[model samples]
Target: MRRVIVIPARLSSTRLKEKPLTIIVDKPLIRWVVEGCLKTGEEVILATDSERIADTVKDLNVKVVYTPSELPSGSDRVAYALRDERVDHVINYQGDEPFVYTEDIKRLFKALEDFPVATLACRDTEFYKDPASVKVVIAEDGTALYFSRSSIPFMKLHSDLYPLKHVGIYAFRKEVLLEFTSWGQGHLERLESLEQLRLLEKGLKIKVLLTDNYYHGVDTEDDVKVVSERLLKKLSNPTTNW
Candidate 1:
Protein backbone atom coordinates (compact mmCIF):
# COMPACT_ATOMS: atom_id res chain seq x y z
CA MET A 1 0.00 0.00 0.00
CA ARG A 2 1.12 3.52 -0.74
CA ARG A 3 2.11 5.50 2.36
CA VAL A 4 2.44 9.27 2.72
CA ILE A 5 3.77 11.41 5.56
CA VAL A 6 2.16 14.75 6.39
CA ILE A 7 3.88 17.24 8.69
CA PRO A 8 1.65 19.66 10.59
CA ALA A 9 3.40 23.04 10.99
CA ARG A 10 1.98 26.37 12.14
CA LEU A 11 3.35 29.83 12.81
CA SER A 12 1.59 30.18 16.14
CA SER A 13 3.27 28.12 18.81
CA THR A 14 2.39 29.11 22.38
CA ARG A 15 5.92 28.67 23.72
CA LEU A 16 7.98 29.49 20.66
CA LYS A 17 6.37 31.56 17.94
CA GLU A 18 7.25 30.54 14.34
CA LYS A 19 8.86 27.43 15.76
CA PRO A 20 8.93 25.73 12.37
CA LEU A 21 11.34 28.38 11.12
CA THR A 22 13.66 28.12 14.08
CA ILE A 23 17.09 26.88 13.07
CA ILE A 24 18.89 23.90 14.54
CA VAL A 25 22.36 23.25 13.11
CA ASP A 26 21.79 26.17 10.70
CA LYS A 27 18.87 24.41 8.99
CA PRO A 28 15.23 25.17 9.64
CA LEU A 29 13.76 22.74 12.16
CA ILE A 30 10.93 21.86 9.79
CA ARG A 31 13.51 20.99 7.14
CA TRP A 32 15.18 18.55 9.50
CA VAL A 33 11.81 16.95 10.32
CA VAL A 34 10.90 16.72 6.63
CA GLU A 35 14.30 15.17 5.95
CA GLY A 36 13.64 12.50 8.58
CA CYS A 37 10.16 11.87 7.20
CA LEU A 38 11.60 11.45 3.73
CA LYS A 39 14.00 8.84 5.07
CA THR A 40 10.95 6.58 5.44
CA GLY A 41 10.94 6.62 1.60
CA GLU A 42 7.26 7.64 1.55
CA GLU A 43 5.72 10.61 -0.21
CA VAL A 44 5.81 13.62 2.16
CA ILE A 45 3.69 16.75 2.36
CA LEU A 46 4.21 19.65 4.75
CA ALA A 47 0.84 20.92 5.98
CA THR A 48 1.07 24.38 7.40
CA ASP A 49 -1.00 27.52 8.17
CA SER A 50 1.55 30.10 7.07
CA GLU A 51 3.09 31.15 3.79
CA ARG A 52 6.46 31.79 5.42
CA ILE A 53 6.85 28.19 6.52
CA ALA A 54 5.64 27.07 3.11
CA ASP A 55 8.15 29.29 1.38
CA THR A 56 10.94 28.27 3.71
CA VAL A 57 10.47 24.61 2.91
CA LYS A 58 9.80 25.36 -0.74
CA ASP A 59 13.41 26.52 -1.00
CA LEU A 60 14.36 23.01 0.11
CA ASN A 61 12.28 21.57 -2.78
CA VAL A 62 9.80 20.02 -0.34
CA LYS A 63 6.03 19.63 -0.98
CA VAL A 64 3.72 21.62 1.26
CA VAL A 65 -0.01 22.33 1.67
CA TYR A 66 -1.63 25.43 3.08
CA THR A 67 -3.85 24.16 5.88
CA PRO A 68 -5.95 26.44 8.04
CA SER A 69 -4.66 27.36 11.49
CA GLU A 70 -7.91 26.67 13.33
CA LEU A 71 -7.44 22.90 13.32
CA PRO A 72 -7.56 21.61 16.91
CA SER A 73 -4.40 19.51 16.69
CA GLY A 74 -1.71 18.06 14.43
CA SER A 75 -3.88 15.07 13.55
CA ASP A 76 -6.64 17.38 12.42
CA ARG A 77 -4.20 19.24 10.20
CA VAL A 78 -2.93 15.98 8.71
CA ALA A 79 -6.48 14.69 8.19
CA TYR A 80 -7.40 17.89 6.38
CA ALA A 81 -4.30 17.67 4.20
CA LEU A 82 -4.89 14.03 3.25
CA ARG A 83 -8.57 14.47 2.39
CA ASP A 84 -9.23 13.25 -1.17
CA GLU A 85 -5.67 11.93 -1.38
CA ARG A 86 -4.96 8.55 -2.97
CA VAL A 87 -2.47 7.28 -0.42
CA ASP A 88 -3.32 4.11 1.56
CA HIS A 89 -1.75 5.35 4.79
CA VAL A 90 -0.78 8.66 6.41
CA ILE A 91 1.80 9.40 9.09
CA ASN A 92 1.50 12.56 11.11
CA TYR A 93 4.96 14.14 11.69
CA GLN A 94 5.30 17.02 14.06
CA GLY A 95 7.28 20.02 12.74
CA ASP A 96 8.96 20.74 16.06
CA GLU A 97 10.52 17.28 16.33
CA PRO A 98 13.64 18.01 14.34
CA PHE A 99 15.59 15.30 16.12
CA VAL A 100 13.15 12.46 15.36
CA TYR A 101 14.96 9.39 14.07
CA THR A 102 14.18 8.04 10.61
CA GLU A 103 14.67 4.43 11.66
CA ASP A 104 12.10 4.89 14.42
CA ILE A 105 9.72 6.37 11.83
CA LYS A 106 10.17 3.32 9.58
CA ARG A 107 9.55 1.05 12.55
CA LEU A 108 6.25 2.74 13.24
CA PHE A 109 5.30 2.41 9.58
CA LYS A 110 6.13 -1.27 9.66
CA ALA A 111 3.99 -1.61 12.80
CA LEU A 112 0.88 -0.35 11.00
CA GLU A 113 0.57 -3.66 9.18
CA ASP A 114 -0.79 -5.24 12.37
CA PHE A 115 -2.54 -2.32 14.04
CA PRO A 116 -5.09 0.37 13.21
CA VAL A 117 -2.80 3.20 14.29
CA ALA A 118 0.93 3.00 15.07
CA THR A 119 3.11 5.23 17.32
CA LEU A 120 6.30 5.07 19.35
CA ALA A 121 6.95 5.17 23.11
CA CYS A 122 10.26 5.32 25.00
CA ARG A 123 11.58 5.29 28.58
CA ASP A 124 10.20 8.14 30.65
CA THR A 125 12.02 10.82 32.68
CA GLU A 126 10.97 13.77 34.84
CA PHE A 127 10.75 15.62 31.56
CA TYR A 128 8.61 12.86 30.11
CA LYS A 129 6.32 12.78 33.13
CA ASP A 130 5.51 16.49 32.98
CA PRO A 131 1.88 17.30 32.19
CA ALA A 132 3.17 18.98 29.06
CA SER A 133 4.71 15.66 28.07
CA VAL A 134 1.83 13.41 27.03
CA LYS A 135 2.00 9.81 28.31
CA VAL A 136 0.52 6.55 27.02
CA VAL A 137 -0.38 3.22 28.60
CA ILE A 138 -0.08 0.11 26.46
CA ALA A 139 -1.60 -3.33 26.89
CA GLU A 140 0.54 -6.45 26.77
CA ASP A 141 -0.23 -6.86 23.08
CA GLY A 142 1.51 -3.52 22.39
CA THR A 143 -1.74 -1.71 21.79
CA ALA A 144 -2.26 1.68 23.43
CA LEU A 145 -5.08 1.69 26.00
CA TYR A 146 -4.94 5.41 26.69
CA PHE A 147 -2.90 8.63 26.17
CA SER A 148 -2.85 11.51 28.60
CA ARG A 149 -0.86 14.48 29.93
CA SER A 150 -0.82 12.96 33.41
CA SER A 151 1.54 10.06 34.29
CA ILE A 152 -0.04 6.66 33.68
CA PRO A 153 0.22 2.97 34.62
CA PHE A 154 0.44 3.66 38.33
CA MET A 155 2.53 0.71 39.53
CA LYS A 156 3.43 -0.08 43.13
CA LEU A 157 6.87 -1.63 42.62
CA HIS A 158 7.35 -2.22 38.90
CA SER A 159 6.68 1.41 37.95
CA ASP A 160 10.02 1.39 36.18
CA LEU A 161 8.72 -1.40 33.96
CA TYR A 162 6.05 0.90 32.50
CA PRO A 163 7.94 4.18 32.21
CA LEU A 164 7.06 4.88 28.62
CA LYS A 165 7.27 8.23 26.88
CA HIS A 166 4.81 9.03 24.11
CA VAL A 167 6.30 10.20 20.84
CA GLY A 168 4.32 12.55 18.55
CA ILE A 169 4.71 10.32 15.50
CA TYR A 170 1.65 8.40 14.33
CA ALA A 171 0.76 6.20 11.35
CA PHE A 172 -2.90 5.98 10.36
CA ARG A 173 -5.00 4.15 7.86
CA LYS A 174 -6.61 6.56 5.40
CA GLU A 175 -10.11 5.76 6.65
CA VAL A 176 -9.14 5.96 10.31
CA LEU A 177 -7.46 9.29 9.70
CA LEU A 178 -10.61 10.72 8.20
CA GLU A 179 -12.77 9.12 10.86
CA PHE A 180 -10.69 10.70 13.62
CA THR A 181 -11.17 14.08 12.02
CA SER A 182 -14.93 13.57 11.82
CA TRP A 183 -15.34 12.80 15.50
CA GLY A 184 -15.39 15.61 18.04
CA GLN A 185 -12.83 15.72 20.82
CA GLY A 186 -14.00 13.77 23.93
CA HIS A 187 -13.99 14.48 27.67
CA LEU A 188 -10.71 12.67 28.32
CA GLU A 189 -9.23 14.59 25.45
CA ARG A 190 -10.26 17.86 27.04
CA LEU A 191 -9.16 16.93 30.56
CA GLU A 192 -5.77 15.72 29.40
CA SER A 193 -5.60 18.12 26.44
CA LEU A 194 -4.52 15.21 24.27
CA GLU A 195 -6.30 14.22 21.07
CA GLN A 196 -5.05 10.61 20.99
CA LEU A 197 -7.33 9.82 23.95
CA ARG A 198 -10.31 10.58 21.77
CA LEU A 199 -9.34 7.57 19.66
CA LEU A 200 -9.06 5.37 22.73
CA GLU A 201 -12.42 6.66 23.97
CA LYS A 202 -13.94 5.62 20.64
CA GLY A 203 -12.50 2.10 21.04
CA LEU A 204 -9.97 2.50 18.26
CA LYS A 205 -6.92 0.29 18.60
CA ILE A 206 -3.53 2.09 18.59
CA LYS A 207 -0.30 0.13 18.36
CA VAL A 208 2.48 1.25 20.65
CA LEU A 209 6.00 0.58 19.34
CA LEU A 210 8.71 0.88 21.97
CA THR A 211 12.17 2.27 21.24
CA ASP A 212 15.28 2.71 23.39
CA ASN A 213 16.27 6.01 21.75
CA TYR A 214 14.30 9.26 21.50
CA TYR A 215 15.03 12.98 20.91
CA HIS A 216 13.96 16.21 22.54
CA GLY A 217 12.17 18.85 20.46
CA VAL A 218 12.25 22.58 20.24
CA ASP A 219 9.29 23.96 22.16
CA THR A 220 10.74 27.12 23.66
CA GLU A 221 13.78 29.33 23.09
CA ASP A 222 15.66 27.31 25.68
CA ASP A 223 14.65 24.14 23.90
CA VAL A 224 15.96 25.57 20.65
CA LYS A 225 19.35 26.18 22.25
CA VAL A 226 19.50 22.69 23.69
CA VAL A 227 18.51 20.99 20.43
CA SER A 228 20.94 23.20 18.53
CA GLU A 229 23.81 22.21 20.79
CA ARG A 230 22.91 18.55 20.50
CA LEU A 231 22.59 18.72 16.72
CA LEU A 232 25.91 20.53 16.50
CA LYS A 233 27.58 17.93 18.65
CA LYS A 234 25.92 15.21 16.59
CA LEU A 235 27.32 16.78 13.44
CA SER A 236 30.72 17.17 15.05
CA ASN A 237 30.91 13.51 16.05
CA PRO A 238 29.58 11.52 13.12
CA THR A 239 30.21 8.17 14.85
CA THR A 240 28.39 9.06 18.05
CA ASN A 241 25.15 7.28 18.86
CA TRP A 242 21.95 9.13 17.98
Candidate 2:
Protein backbone atom coordinates (compact mmCIF):
# COMPACT_ATOMS: atom_id res chain seq x y z
CA MET A 1 0.00 0.00 0.00
CA ARG A 2 1.10 3.59 -0.63
CA ARG A 3 2.36 5.27 2.54
CA VAL A 4 3.44 8.82 3.37
CA ILE A 5 4.42 11.11 6.25
CA VAL A 6 2.62 14.43 6.76
CA ILE A 7 4.08 16.95 9.21
CA PRO A 8 1.81 19.70 10.58
CA ALA A 9 3.50 22.87 11.83
CA ARG A 10 2.22 26.26 12.94
CA LEU A 11 3.94 29.40 14.25
CA SER A 12 1.25 30.37 16.76
CA SER A 13 1.95 27.96 19.55
CA THR A 14 0.53 28.44 23.04
CA ARG A 15 3.65 27.43 24.92
CA LEU A 16 6.57 28.36 22.74
CA LYS A 17 6.59 31.26 20.30
CA GLU A 18 7.35 30.42 16.66
CA LYS A 19 8.10 26.80 17.56
CA PRO A 20 8.46 25.51 14.01
CA LEU A 21 10.99 28.17 13.08
CA THR A 22 13.00 27.75 16.28
CA ILE A 23 16.60 26.89 15.44
CA ILE A 24 18.26 23.85 16.94
CA VAL A 25 21.93 23.46 16.17
CA ASP A 26 22.36 24.94 12.68
CA LYS A 27 18.94 24.13 11.17
CA PRO A 28 15.35 25.04 11.99
CA LEU A 29 13.36 22.56 14.11
CA ILE A 30 10.97 21.87 11.24
CA ARG A 31 13.91 21.15 8.99
CA TRP A 32 15.17 18.53 11.43
CA VAL A 33 11.76 16.82 11.37
CA VAL A 34 11.58 16.94 7.55
CA GLU A 35 15.10 15.64 7.06
CA GLY A 36 14.54 12.73 9.44
CA CYS A 37 11.33 11.75 7.63
CA LEU A 38 13.14 12.08 4.30
CA LYS A 39 15.81 9.72 5.56
CA THR A 40 13.07 7.08 5.82
CA GLY A 41 12.81 7.29 2.00
CA GLU A 42 9.05 7.80 2.13
CA GLU A 43 7.07 10.61 0.59
CA VAL A 44 6.78 13.48 3.12
CA ILE A 45 4.36 16.38 2.89
CA LEU A 46 4.69 19.36 5.24
CA ALA A 47 1.34 20.90 6.10
CA THR A 48 1.73 24.34 7.61
CA ASP A 49 -0.06 27.69 7.87
CA SER A 50 3.09 29.79 7.60
CA GLU A 51 4.95 30.42 4.34
CA ARG A 52 8.09 31.02 6.38
CA ILE A 53 7.83 27.52 7.87
CA ALA A 54 7.26 26.12 4.38
CA ASP A 55 10.29 28.00 3.06
CA THR A 56 12.76 26.41 5.50
CA VAL A 57 12.48 22.96 3.92
CA LYS A 58 12.28 24.25 0.31
CA ASP A 59 15.57 22.69 -0.77
CA LEU A 60 14.67 19.31 0.68
CA ASN A 61 13.05 16.44 -1.25
CA VAL A 62 9.56 16.86 0.18
CA LYS A 63 6.20 18.34 -0.76
CA VAL A 64 4.87 21.39 1.09
CA VAL A 65 1.21 22.45 1.31
CA TYR A 66 -0.36 25.48 2.95
CA THR A 67 -3.35 24.91 5.21
CA PRO A 68 -5.55 27.43 7.00
CA SER A 69 -4.02 29.01 10.09
CA GLU A 70 -7.29 28.47 11.95
CA LEU A 71 -7.01 24.70 11.67
CA PRO A 72 -7.63 23.28 15.16
CA SER A 73 -4.92 20.68 15.54
CA GLY A 74 -1.95 18.99 13.86
CA SER A 75 -3.96 15.91 12.96
CA ASP A 76 -6.46 18.10 11.17
CA ARG A 77 -3.64 19.74 9.27
CA VAL A 78 -2.31 16.36 8.19
CA ALA A 79 -5.72 15.21 7.05
CA TYR A 80 -6.18 18.44 5.11
CA ALA A 81 -2.89 17.99 3.28
CA LEU A 82 -3.65 14.40 2.25
CA ARG A 83 -7.11 15.34 0.93
CA ASP A 84 -5.76 15.73 -2.63
CA GLU A 85 -3.14 13.00 -2.52
CA ARG A 86 -3.59 9.36 -3.43
CA VAL A 87 -2.27 7.88 -0.22
CA ASP A 88 -3.33 4.66 1.53
CA HIS A 89 -1.45 5.06 4.82
CA VAL A 90 -0.01 8.10 6.57
CA ILE A 91 2.00 8.98 9.68
CA ASN A 92 1.04 12.30 11.26
CA TYR A 93 4.56 13.16 12.28
CA GLN A 94 4.52 16.19 14.59
CA GLY A 95 6.80 19.08 13.58
CA ASP A 96 8.12 19.65 17.10
CA GLU A 97 9.24 16.04 17.34
CA PRO A 98 12.74 16.22 15.89
CA PHE A 99 13.74 12.65 16.66
CA VAL A 100 12.60 10.18 13.99
CA TYR A 101 13.62 6.57 13.62
CA THR A 102 13.14 4.95 10.21
CA GLU A 103 12.43 1.57 11.78
CA ASP A 104 9.73 3.07 14.02
CA ILE A 105 8.15 4.74 11.00
CA LYS A 106 8.16 1.42 9.16
CA ARG A 107 6.60 -0.36 12.12
CA LEU A 108 3.76 2.15 12.42
CA PHE A 109 2.93 1.86 8.69
CA LYS A 110 3.20 -1.92 8.86
CA ALA A 111 0.69 -1.93 11.72
CA LEU A 112 -1.94 -0.49 9.38
CA GLU A 113 -2.33 -3.98 7.92
CA ASP A 114 -4.22 -4.93 11.11
CA PHE A 115 -5.26 -1.69 12.74
CA PRO A 116 -6.97 1.50 11.60
CA VAL A 117 -4.87 3.62 13.97
CA ALA A 118 -1.55 2.99 15.68
CA THR A 119 0.81 5.06 17.90
CA LEU A 120 4.05 4.68 19.81
CA ALA A 121 4.58 4.50 23.58
CA CYS A 122 7.36 3.61 25.97
CA ARG A 123 7.92 2.69 29.61
CA ASP A 124 8.56 5.77 31.68
CA THR A 125 7.31 6.56 35.17
CA GLU A 126 9.08 9.87 35.44
CA PHE A 127 6.36 11.79 33.65
CA TYR A 128 3.45 10.21 35.46
CA LYS A 129 2.78 13.37 37.41
CA ASP A 130 3.66 15.80 34.65
CA PRO A 131 0.47 17.07 33.07
CA ALA A 132 2.31 17.83 29.87
CA SER A 133 3.08 14.13 29.38
CA VAL A 134 0.16 12.02 28.25
CA LYS A 135 -0.27 8.55 29.69
CA VAL A 136 -2.03 5.59 28.16
CA VAL A 137 -3.46 2.42 29.65
CA ILE A 138 -3.76 -0.52 27.26
CA ALA A 139 -5.92 -3.61 27.23
CA GLU A 140 -4.52 -7.13 27.14
CA ASP A 141 -4.62 -7.14 23.35
CA GLY A 142 -2.32 -4.12 23.01
CA THR A 143 -5.19 -1.76 22.24
CA ALA A 144 -5.42 1.49 24.19
CA LEU A 145 -8.19 1.64 26.74
CA TYR A 146 -7.71 5.29 27.64
CA PHE A 147 -5.35 8.24 27.15
CA SER A 148 -5.03 10.92 29.81
CA ARG A 149 -2.79 13.66 31.10
CA SER A 150 -3.55 12.63 34.68
CA SER A 151 -1.87 9.73 36.47
CA ILE A 152 -3.65 6.49 35.63
CA PRO A 153 -4.16 3.13 37.41
CA PHE A 154 -3.55 4.94 40.75
CA MET A 155 -0.43 2.85 41.34
CA LYS A 156 -1.92 1.13 44.41
CA LEU A 157 0.04 -1.96 43.48
CA HIS A 158 3.79 -1.84 43.00
CA SER A 159 4.96 -2.52 39.51
CA ASP A 160 7.38 -0.99 37.02
CA LEU A 161 5.08 -1.21 33.99
CA TYR A 162 1.77 0.55 34.61
CA PRO A 163 2.11 4.16 33.46
CA LEU A 164 3.14 4.27 29.81
CA LYS A 165 4.32 7.60 28.42
CA HIS A 166 2.53 8.24 25.16
CA VAL A 167 4.56 9.47 22.25
CA GLY A 168 2.63 11.95 20.07
CA ILE A 169 3.40 10.25 16.74
CA TYR A 170 0.43 8.60 15.08
CA ALA A 171 -0.11 6.44 11.98
CA PHE A 172 -3.51 6.15 10.36
CA ARG A 173 -5.22 4.62 7.36
CA LYS A 174 -6.18 7.46 5.03
CA GLU A 175 -9.91 6.83 5.28
CA VAL A 176 -9.74 6.57 9.04
CA LEU A 177 -7.92 9.89 9.23
CA LEU A 178 -10.55 11.60 7.08
CA GLU A 179 -13.33 10.29 9.27
CA PHE A 180 -11.41 11.13 12.43
CA THR A 181 -11.06 14.77 11.45
CA SER A 182 -14.71 14.98 10.54
CA TRP A 183 -15.92 13.81 13.94
CA GLY A 184 -16.86 16.36 16.57
CA GLN A 185 -14.83 16.63 19.75
CA GLY A 186 -15.84 14.35 22.62
CA HIS A 187 -16.19 15.10 26.35
CA LEU A 188 -13.08 13.20 27.42
CA GLU A 189 -11.09 14.77 24.63
CA ARG A 190 -12.11 18.21 25.78
CA LEU A 191 -11.36 17.40 29.41
CA GLU A 192 -7.90 16.08 28.74
CA SER A 193 -7.17 18.52 25.92
CA LEU A 194 -5.91 15.62 23.84
CA GLU A 195 -7.12 15.02 20.30
CA GLN A 196 -6.55 11.27 20.38
CA LEU A 197 -9.24 10.85 23.02
CA ARG A 198 -11.79 11.89 20.44
CA LEU A 199 -11.03 8.69 18.57
CA LEU A 200 -11.33 6.54 21.69
CA GLU A 201 -14.64 8.16 22.58
CA LYS A 202 -15.96 7.20 19.15
CA GLY A 203 -15.17 3.54 19.97
CA LEU A 204 -12.36 3.24 17.43
CA LYS A 205 -9.59 0.91 18.51
CA ILE A 206 -6.12 2.47 18.67
CA LYS A 207 -3.19 0.08 18.63
CA VAL A 208 -0.28 1.00 20.87
CA LEU A 209 3.22 0.06 19.77
CA LEU A 210 5.85 0.16 22.50
CA THR A 211 9.48 0.95 21.74
CA ASP A 212 12.66 1.70 23.72
CA ASN A 213 13.83 4.32 21.30
CA TYR A 214 14.14 7.84 22.73
CA TYR A 215 11.54 10.25 21.36
CA HIS A 216 11.07 13.86 22.54
CA GLY A 217 9.28 16.94 21.21
CA VAL A 218 10.22 20.57 21.80
CA ASP A 219 7.57 22.48 23.69
CA THR A 220 9.45 24.74 26.13
CA GLU A 221 12.78 26.42 26.70
CA ASP A 222 14.05 23.43 28.67
CA ASP A 223 12.97 21.07 25.88
CA VAL A 224 14.89 23.15 23.36
CA LYS A 225 18.04 22.88 25.44
CA VAL A 226 17.71 19.10 25.96
CA VAL A 227 16.70 18.38 22.36
CA SER A 228 19.52 20.48 20.99
CA GLU A 229 22.06 18.36 22.84
CA ARG A 230 20.59 15.07 21.60
CA LEU A 231 20.01 16.31 18.06
CA LEU A 232 23.59 17.45 17.85
CA LYS A 233 24.74 14.04 18.95
CA LYS A 234 22.59 12.36 16.30
CA LEU A 235 23.76 14.68 13.52
CA SER A 236 27.40 14.57 14.53
CA ASN A 237 27.49 10.81 14.74
CA PRO A 238 28.15 9.07 11.41
CA THR A 239 26.49 5.90 12.68
CA THR A 240 23.13 5.37 14.49
CA ASN A 241 24.72 5.11 17.94
CA TRP A 242 23.02 8.11 19.52
Best by lDDT: 2
TM-score for candidate 2: 0.96
TM-score of each: 0.93, 0.96
For model 1, residues 204-239, the per-residue Cα lDDT tens digits are 899988888757777988888888887888899978
Deviation of model 2 at 93, angstroms:
0.2
Candidate 2, 100: how far from true, in Å?
0.2
- The alpha-carbon RMSD values of the candidates against the true structure, listed in the order shown, are 1.6, 1.3
Give stretches of model 2 more than 4 Å off.
236-241
Off by over 4 Å in 1: none
Determine which window of 10 residues in candidate 1 has minimal summed lDDT. Answer: 153-162
Clashes of 1: 0
